[model samples]
Target: MPQHFLLSAEARNLSPIAIARMSEYEAVMTMKKLRWGEGKDVICPRCGKKHEAYYIKSRKQWQCKECNYRFSVTAGTLFAHHKLPLRDILFACSLYVNAAKGISALQIARDLNVQYKTAFVLLHKIKEALKVHKQRETMQLSGVVHMDATYVHSSQKPKNKKSERVDRRLKQHENPLKRAILVIRDSFAKQDDEQNTKQIGARNTIAFIAKSENSKVVNQLANKHITKGSTIHTDESPAYDNLIYFHDLKRVNHQKEYRSDAGVTNNLAESYFSRFKRMYYGQVHKMNNTYLYEYANEIAYREDTRRLSNGVIFNDVVSKCLTSLPSDDWRGYWQGNKKRVETLAA
Candidate 1:
């Protein structure tokens, strides 16, 4: 698809608010309805031939007449091979994406009334889905791209046995088990030609969970999505000092001045992190690195779709979940939804 057309199509479909209010079962059923026979014969997986298929809503499966093949709607998709009711999965995804910070597995289990392990596994699956979607897109964070980092605690830390050098090192940096999230924000130009300042436009976020605050990591991320010569804004963290090596880097020393000649700052990204920290600290409390990135993507995805109505968000997430690639598992589907959310915001 042409980039603009694909983007516009996604924009028309993107909505986060709607998804928040939906029950998991309803979302799954709705997705099943959209993917089922819409005046077209179901293609037989075994023969690759179009077959007459009838929907058995009770079982949520399709029975083919020509081949006598019966398959559940979730058979080939991520929803297949799961023992959890479709409703619980859908609800988990809804809760997962809607929260600004994140929902812990225990909380998810409580809300869905499932086991903690079930909730944990479900969250991991959805996160894996989000990761697949991230790999599919090419980001062009043109205009002003704000960059910054925030810390999130890991789920577990090794016990200290003795004069523990590693433990001491970790404590020196405000907890060694904490992971840093590097985020980038796109700043749009505001009206008023006289001010000539970049106004905040639609906001989107890309988060990386890293151990060390290093320029190499920042540049690696920049090279992936940002175009050459694009204006980049960041605080005077030594790690970001080398950004000029790649893009049009501009710096604001938070220790001194907060703005530069570009009249832009990393405040946008910082504001996002503040919201993230509140949720991470207040609601969920703790998360491991494995799940931290997923939660970050979920939060970012919701923020991108905050303006849309609840119904729109629900439909968009379902649609993106259906069409996303790599692994069609639950995690892949959510990741795909996140990618679509980011693209629409862009």
Candidate 2:
């Protein structure tokens, strides 16, 4: 959990060249086997049975002994439905882990010699897989938890709806459908211990869209993601007033001082918000509200695992893809459904 552990994980996984050096068939076979179970035991994607299928070498698939069904290693998974070769998939994964900040779909297309559509879908699938991992493995923050909120405006814009009469203040949020972010971080926990059991802080993050920074919203978030008796730190926000009775509440007055007499500051949460805002405004350019949860989840995952090596991060993302269902398809991706991100914080 000490920062040194991230450096240690770097030298452990095989270099990208080594993984890329694998034959197309070999790489596919190896990763698929790893996804299903042991590298030797192939799972029947049709029936979800392990060690009960025979590898049909000629056709490169499995014959489930139980169901007598035919399937490929990628069958039933997002990779199962893709037309790209397994090697290309693995290489794309390598790119994913290497680009800690994030690699755009255009970059992936150029690197893999694939169409923009293919690259975009592949990356979105991985992000969605990350979302599934987040939802399934939601962590509760204990010791010294920090909570704060920020906003990311909707990308939608009005072409001619705006006129000179528009209030100057209203112009700032043209698409006033602002997306509120509620984030909580464990100030006392490390990402993981030497054993990699994820005890202290491997996955301790709470984030999701909120309606407003109101007392009801803060109170709900505190009760849900934060555990009882844990100390909560924040700025002098009226919304957090309700949390005082339930939690060991402490606050810092930003107007007068950054830190209080008790050494309380929501700096950790602010640091996370700053990084997220930069990534959102600078890198991603714009975010559609529909997939906001997945994007936020990616931020949490990246920040939480920032210390881990690219190889380890790549491996973890791919492992989660095995059980993850794909998100909205290509055509529907941009068509926003405007789902209320509240109550659905990953």
Residues 1-346 of candidate 1: C-alpha lDDT, one tens digit per residue: 4354223444354243454466655555566555553554565554556756776666666777767777755665545577886666666766665554666788898988888777876776665556557657676787778888876564345556655535434545456466678888776566647877543454567777777567878878888767778888887788877779768888888877777665767887877777787777787776655456777776666656655544466555555555443353334333343223111111
Query: Candidate 2: where is the Cα deviation over 4 Å?
Result: 1-14, 154-174, 189-203, 326-346
Evaluate all candidate structures by whole-model CA lDDT and list the values in order.
0.64, 0.73
lDDT by residue for model 2 over 1-346, one digit each (tens)?
4656556756347466776678867876767756875656776766777775687878777788889999876766666566787778888888887765667788889988988877977887888788767778657788888888887784444456556344435647455567678888985355445656544432466677875677887887788788998898888889899888988998999999988887888887887787788767666776677777777877788888776667668778877777665444433444543344433443
Give model 2's TM-score versus the native structure.
0.83
- In candidate 1, stretches whose alpha carbon ends up further than 4 angstroms from where it belongs are 1-29, 36-52, 65-67, 154-178, 191-199, 257-262, 323-346
